[model samples]
Each structure stands twice: as structure tokens, then as C-alpha cells.
Target: MSSAVISISNQKGGTGKTTLTMNLAAGLARRGRTLVVDADPQGSALQWAGLSSDEKPFPVSVIAVADNLGREVGRFAEDYQYVLIDCPPTLETEVTRAAMRIADTVLIPTLPSPVDLWASLRLANAIEEVKLRNPRLAAYILVNQLEPRSALSQGMKQALEEFDIPALNSHLRRRAIYRNAALEGLSVYCMGKRGEPAAAEIDAIIEEVL
Candidate 1:
């Protein structure tokens, strides 16, 4: 099968883009070969990879190119079954656009809040623009950092219905394990008992995407 390039992106910062990118890459790596391309200059994904010893689960490459990110990622498409790109937050950056242009799917991770949902409209617009160049590009919004008991969470889902992009049914609940795992450069999959729920959620996303 050909490689599927999925770009985990959001124009807003602190939207859990990097976190989702890392975990999703890990989840897919367990089933098949996966490569994560860190297109963000912040290097959070790169840092996560650095924490791994000689037995790194998967390889992560940092490629912060503003002009030809699609071309850069394409070079590895033939080798791996999946290529996940961790894109920068700013929509004004060319790298984000380039990544979207080449991505078969773009996963937008947004916090379930009024401010975050409002800020994500710009990214929704950017996706529309990228669709012009990449007619087959499929984009979906993933509700992240969700507080299930909060009224805002329900409201956010209802509000997202009016947006152009569709939000996935599978969501990530607000959990401390996510934070703990990131500190150790490990996915929730490696956290044993505490990470089971988080790992399940990531698995659901992978199942839906594939």
C-alpha cells in the first residue's frame, strides 16, 4: 500500500497538535512502519524523540522548510507506510501551507472552548484554500483536551456543527496522563495502567483515519 501523509496542524498554539502528532505516530508505529516529520520550528516533537534511547520506537526528522515541505516529506513517502507531519501553528507561514498541500489528510486538533473554537475558524479557512491546490485533501477537526462533565464541552460540539469542517466523533478527554507521558517522551501506550484510556482514544483515532 502507498503511504498516507497526515499532517497534525492548527493555526492556534497550545491546541495539542504536537501531543497528538507524537501519540498518533506511536500508535501507528506499533502496527506498521511510521515516520514523523517535525515541520514546526519549536522542535517539541524533536525533543520527544531525543528523550528516547538507542531503542527509539520510531524515527522523527526535523524539517522546518517554509517553501517545499511537501517535497521534503514526499521523499520519505515510499519508504514508510505512514508519514505524520507536526506543522507549525501560524497560518501565515508557508511551511504550514506546503504541508497541507501535500497531505492526504489534515487533522486539526482544537480545544473544546469558545476561544479555541473561534480561533480555529481561520485554520478552517486555510484548509479550504489548500483544498484548491489539493482537491483530494481531507480535513477533520479533533476535539482535544475535552472536559466531559463541563457544559462548555457539549456547547463546543454543538457549535462545531455550524462550521464547514466536520469534527470527529472520537475525542480526547482532559487527563493528566497526557502531560505525564510527554515529560518522559513516551506515549500513553508506554504508561501501563494509567495510559490505557489515553492509548485507547489514540487507537480509535487511528482506526477511524485508516
Candidate 2:
């Protein structure tokens, strides 16, 4: 089968989009060939790949093209089992739209906050617009950096119930391990004991999505 293209997108920055993209890519790489396509001009995912160890499992490609990215990425998808695109945090960008045009699934990572929730709705609206071209496109909201004990987390779930897009049952907690692992150009899976939970969460997401 051709690789499934999954786009990690959010209209708001700092929503853990790049973090989710890299970790999810690493998680999926364990089972099969995986490639990450960094569509954001920021090139954060590309920089992460550079910082990664020489033994890193997967390869990342940078594709900043705003037009015809769907066609460009379709060619890359031929060799890998899975392809993930880290999109810029803005729906106004053609790169984001192009990624959505080809993606089988769009994962929107958002913090558990009122602002992030509102932004997710806007992103869902944009995805709906993109669905016009790619009717098979599926989008899911992933609550990231969640503090389970906080009231905000509980409230965020309740608020999401009102939104059109469904939120994933699994969530990623706020943890320093994610940051530490990123700095070392590693995924949570390589963090040993400290990363076990975080790694499991990423694994669950991969399972649920794929």
C-alpha cells in the first residue's frame, strides 16, 4: 500500500505540533519505514533531524513548497510505509492547505486551554474547507501538554464535546522529558525509564490513528 500521509497541524503556535510530529514519526518507524516531511518554513522538524543522533531510525525531508505540495509529497510517499508532514501553524498558508489536500489524516495538537480550543475550532473549519478537494481527509484533535489533575484539562474535554471534530481519547501530559529528549535530538523512546510513559502515549496515538 502507498504510505499514508498524516499532517500534524495547528493554527496556533506552541501547540506541540512539531513535537507530536517527530515523536509520532519515531513511534511509527519502529514498526515500518517512516519519513517525516517538514512543510513549515520554520524547519523545526528538519533542525530536530539535524540534532538527532547518527543512529536515528528515520529520515526527515524538508518541503517548503506552498503550491503543488500534494503532488510533491505523493512522490515521496511511494517508498515509505508512513509519511508525516509537520505543517506551519497557520491555515492562511498555502503549504498548510496543500498538505491537507493530500493527507489521509490531519492531527491537530492543541493545549488544553480556552484559546487553544477556540483555535482548534478555526482549524477544523479550515479542514472542512479542504475536505472539499479531498473528501476522504480525516481530522482529529489531540490534547497535548495536558495536566490531568488540572480543572482546565477536564473542562477542555467538555468543551471539545461541543466542537465538530472529535478529540482523541489518549493525551500527552506536560513533562520535561519531552523537552529534554528533543534537545538531545531523541524521541521519548530513547529516554530510558524517564520516557516510558511519554513513549507509551505516543505509541497509543500511533495505534489509534493508524
Candidate 3:
């Protein structure tokens, strides 16, 4: 398959950008060769993979590159079936824009809160600009940290409707296994039966977006 570049971007910190990037990379790696580009200056992706032991390393290859990130990602795309770029949490930076321009699709993880929705507006503006140049760029919102038994607040749902980009039907819920897998430098897929539900959530995301 020709390389498909997916960029995960968010303007707000603590939006689980790195977590989604890493787990998504793991899912994609299972399907084909996948590379996770740690374009975020924080280097979270790299650090996550670094935690892996040599005996059982991270499932997908990961590397950090801030300089000429778009160009470097293009190079990697030629080799891997999927190249997932983990952009910085802030959208104003050129680094984030660079990744957005080159991506085939962009997934923005958002919390189910009014504050987070406001934060996403700025990102929506950035995406509008990026889409101008790259018309094919498809963007979606993947609701993160969604409470399992809680219903979506009507106000928040109304706010979500204000955005032009549609939110994915699949969402990542608040679960302990996600953190558990991370502590071991592993994706939920490796957590055995304990990871099944979380892994299933990731798999649903894969079905919708990947």
C-alpha cells in the first residue's frame, strides 16, 4: 500500500495527543509497516518508545525530528505503509503547521468540555488555513477521556456542532488500562485480557479512521 500520513494535532496540552499517536501507531503497525514521527518538541513519543526493553521493544518504530519535519516525514513515507506524525500540543507553531500540510488526514483529540471546545476553535482556524493549501486534508475530532457512564452535555454537544470538521463516531474512553500499558512502554494490545476492552476501543478507532 502507498504510504498514508496521519497527523494527530491539538492546541491544548494534556489532550492525550502522544497517547493516541503511540497507540494508533501500534494498531497501524499490526496492519503494515508504520512509523511514528515525534514531531512534538517535547519528544513524548520518543520517550515512550525509549521505555521499551530490548527484549520486547515498542511494536512500531518511533523517532523525533523537529527540523524539517515535513520533509523528513515524506522520506519515511516512502518506506512505511503508514506514517503517523505526532504534532506539538500548540497549533500556532510552524512545526505543527508543517506536519498538517503533509498529512493525508488529521485527528484532533478533544475532551468533552466547553473549555476544550474553545481551545479547539483555534485549531479549527489553523486547519482551515492548512486545508486551503492541501485540499485533500481531512480532519476529525476524536473525543478523548470520555466518561464511561456519563452522557454528553447538551451544551457541549451544541458546541461541537459549531465546528466544521466532524467528530469521529469512535472515541477513547477514560480507562486505567491505557495508563497501565504506557507504564510498561506497551500498547493496550500487549496487556493481555486486561487490555481487551481498551484494545477494542483502539481497534474501533482504527476501523473508522485508519
Candidate 4:
């Protein structure tokens, strides 16, 4: 199979893009080859990998390339079955466009809120822009930091439906464990194969994206 490149992107900050990217990387890595490219200028994903001067290495390798992701990713894609790009929260950046240009699919993470929904549209438009150049590009929106049964989540879901965007049924719920796991360079799925709420959601994403 040609390596499937999935970019976890959002034009707004704190949308859990990196969280989803990292966890999905871990989940897929267990099954087969996976590589994560941190295309964010902030290097948050790199920091999360916990590479220090003393050790100078990490379980997952992350490179700082906020400018030329397509070139960097092209070089890395030969060795991996899947390449996951953790993008910055800006569409105007070249890295985001480069990622979108090369991606087989783009996973846009949005919170179930009006503000997030608005931001999601902007990201969606950017994806569309990339699609114009690469007509075969596939993209989907995944809800993150969501609270089920709340009026806001319901309203946002309804709003998303009004638009033509395909939103994934599986969502990442608001939980403290997500925060805790990032500190250890681990995904919630690593907590266990059983009784792990996040694993189901991550699996759902894999099913939909694949």
C-alpha cells in the first residue's frame, strides 16, 4: 500500500490536534509502521516526545519543519506505512499547505462549540483550497474535547450537519486522563487494551480514516 498521510490540523489553537495526532500514531504504531512529523512551529509534539540533550533520542522521532513539510515528509514516507503530520494552528503557513498538499486525508479536530465550529469552517476552506490543486484529497472533521448530551454539543452537531462537511461519529470526550498521558509521552490507549475509553474513540478514527 502507498503510505497514507493523515494530517491532524486546525486553524485554531488548543483544539487537541497534537493530542489526536500522537495518540493515533501510538495506536497505529502497535499495528504496523508509523511516523509522526511535527510541522508545528511551536514544536509541541517534539517537546512531548521528550528528547533531552542527555539522552538525545526518543521512542518516536519528531523533526522541526514548520516551513517545508512536503519535502521533509516525502523523504520520510518511504520507510513508513503511515505518516501522521501534527500541524500548527495556521492555514497561511507554508507547512500546513505542504502537509495538505501531500496528505491522503486530513483530520480536522474541532471542539463542540460555536467558536470551534467557526474555526473548523476556516480550516475546511483551507482544505478545499488544497483540494482544488489535488482533487483526490479526502478530509473529515473529528470532534474533540466534547461533552455528550449537552446543549452546546447538540447545537454544534446540528450546525455541522447544516454544512456539507462529514463529521466522524466517534469523538474524544473531555477527560483529565488525556492531559495526564501527554506528560508521559503516552496515549490513553497505552493505559490498557481493556477499560480504556479513549482506545475505542481512537479505533473509530482509524476505521473511518482508513
Please state the error at residue 102 of candidate 3 in Å.
0.2
Instruction: Summing lDDT over every window of 10 consecutive residues in candidate 1, give the lowest-scoring window.
Output: 56-65
Q: By lDDT, who's the top model here? A: 3
Lowest lDDT sum, 10 consecutive residues, model 2, at 57-66
Q: How does each model score on lDDT?
A: 0.85, 0.85, 0.86, 0.80
> Which lDDT tens digits does candidate 3 get at residues 111-144?
8887887888888898899899999899999888
List residue ranges in candidate 4 displaced over 4 A: 51-59, 193-195
TM-score of 2: 0.94
Against the correct fold, how does model 4 do in TM-score?
0.91
| Per-model TM-score versus the true fold | 0.94, 0.94, 0.95, 0.91
lDDT of 2 at 149: 92
Candidate 1 per-residue lDDT over residues 27-48, each given as its tens digit: 9988878888888888888888
Counting clashing residue pairs in each candidate, in order, gives 0, 0, 0, 0
Clashing pairs in 4: none
Give the TM-score (vs. native) of candidate 3: 0.95
lDDT winner, 1 or 4: 1
Residue-level lDDT of model 2, residues 126-209, one tens digit each, is 888999989999999999999999999999989999989998999899999999988987889888999999999999999899
Off by over 4 Å in 2: 55-67
